[model samples]
Target: MLEKHVCVLEGVMVSQDREDFFLLSNCGPKLLEQKGLALGGLGVASINIGLGGKTLVELERPAAYHTTPIFPLIRSDRKRRNKTTYWRRRSCVQDTRIVIAIEPSESDGDELDLPERCRVLKLANSVTYDRMEKSLNQLEKIVLPSSDDTPNDKFLPKLTPLVRVLMGMAQPSEKIPIQELKFFDDTLNASQKEAVRFALECPELPVYMVLQVNTYAHRSDTSTHNHNILERLLALPASQSGTKLKVTRVGHPARVMAHEGVLDATLEVKANRSDQAALAKDVKNELEATLDALSGKGKGAKGKAPRGAERRKMWEEVKALRKEYRQREGGVVRSVLSESQVVLATCHSSGGRQLRDHNFDVVIIDEATQALEAVCWIPIFKAQKLILAGDPMQLPPTILSIDKMKKAKNTGGTPEKSSTTSDKTGGR
Candidate 1:
């Protein structure tokens, strides 16, 4: 079943006169002079008020606008005839301030209706124009759905501000929720504790965790600790019900191992292939000829020592051949990514490669506090969820320029520093 989505717009209304106004809980008033109200089929209307037209008044949601509740008249015989029922004011005067709420009478239409008169409430204070503008801007960005459909209402404008007030507002959190794990015996430090918490709390698959250790020594220690924790988790007993957990680490060592294994296997297969004997013989002859040329052997090479330029040329040719062979085969890094369930890489390594249609369920960054905010976005955009773990109070990213650092400090910004040897190595 397709779920129908409803949008609401809410704001405060300030009036100049005390004229009687009929308030509708769902839709805007039947008759009102206001601008920008025709947009989005929302009951919200913008009105210019005060001297010099500086003060602007906006009606919130029409569904929420109403008057004070009045008790039913009592019967002379002590029997009440009319039950207590909320009613909208037919007329309101100038200088009257009230809160308004509105919703769509029907989906995709300018027509709006009141929900209930009992739900409306008159506000004690009117919302300021500046405050309303700010709130409206925020609401437009956060709540409006990006759609191409246009309503036929003449009053409705290009940009429809269909804002819906959720019954229960849910606030967003800066940190990811972490679940406590009992499988590991090692006592976790403060940083480790937080990382574990995030790992457990994260519900998405293919999670990326980034740790930013400033120095090589710290990075080594942190990586080892993280690997150990992950290993312990992987070592847990299999569930009887139906659950499987897989973890893989993708670092320099892992890539090197994969590369070596691939290279060796490829060489062995080619060496044993019967059809490649001619090609092998030709390659060997060329290699021998090149080596002899570099050594100043045979015809032109029979002279004195080989020139520096000749030797360099021969070496470049050999290097090019080796690179060609590697290119023909596959890369260790690519192989590992294809097989691994969880990839653990430095920010540089993660961003260095061009990923095609490769999206992770979550990306976790450790030591995020020390990483440049720009660098963090690389992995962030590739995942559905992101987890950043780092203590900002520790060392900040290394910025090389003193002038830039000073400027950043003055503006209360953490300047990004030059990459260190460790950073370059880990990125690989």
Candidate 2:
């Protein structure tokens, strides 16, 4: 039998104090499960707008909005009532209540379409299958590079040291020098010190870091007492070679919390100032030289910027080149990996386009057991050293389909959450 999560929302549970606003609460499900209730809801009305305002029909469902909450269908023809105006996804879900978007009042003639003065409140889905699709398309274009030399190329797409170890082709051998810590805590246990030491000494060791990479360094493994390892690493050496370590956390959900905890700060953008670095000045010189060589308006073998349709596209390429020059890394070599330090990001976000721009010194996945293997692969290819920090006892990723969800109850897959290994959490 299909589970019905239907619940009536009225009286104390309902609040409609302002115009064009409708609020409902005392809902059975948690807000997280209902966040995706963006569109395709039937509005209740005076004269049967949908199934005579008697039944709610949900058909041809997409994976995006998986079985949304069953809200009460109340029929009302009152003028003050939000007349049958289904809102596009301008909604917000918080705690037990949801504030659905309401379409603005229309012209007198247009009001007739909202039969019986009632319309479904809905908005288009923002965080949906489309987001994942975009991430996939971007990933596809990136990991596979345009190689002209085929098998003979000296740079064979450069598989990271972490990737080689994962595929069992090699073992990690790179190491980083750790600086002496001025402050020491006697209360801290051996495991904590060991993990901190590992982070400090390992290649892309926790001690050194690049501001351009990630700030989710806050999300570290807690089971092995490494929760404060990142903080401790930052505390140990205030600055490397007179430059302070700069970090900025990224994530929509965690933004407010990070701010409250005093962890949210802009990445050291000034640190990337090309003027101070002198890289931008060099790039500007080279670009001017190139333009001068081709600035004769197609008179010689060297052609000028094109005309018509190709002109805009050609200038766009030039703009991109200029931007790339301004965004060069801090060290001598402009490379896929930053010359400074390690990157720590959540598994899903680690796959983001901007983060994918640079290869990482290290990629640590916290609670690795809870993530899907497919998602884990997204960041796996980007790391020089990979650390999977997880707890075996914790539950794995959720499967939505009923049949598939049932099968997952027994943990039948290879490298199951229950089989978490030392190599996974052996960051220490």
Q: Write the per-residue lDDT of candidate 2 for residues 262-337, one digit (tens) a residue.
A: 2322122222332454655466445434333333223362534344555445444445544555355323223312
Residue 351 displacement in candidate 1 (angstroms): 2.6
After superposition on all CA atoms, what RMSD does each candidate show versus the true structure?
Answer: 32.7, 18.0
The CA lDDT of each predicted structure is 0.36, 0.37
Residue range with the least summed lDDT across 10 consecutive positions in model 1: 1-10
Total backbone collisions for each predicted model:
43, 11
lDDT of 1: 0.36
- State in Å the error of residue 412, model 2: 10
> After best superposition, candidate 2 residue 399: deviation in angstroms?
4.4
Question: Against the correct fold, how does model 1 do in TM-score?
Answer: 0.35
* Top-lDDT structure, candidate number: 2
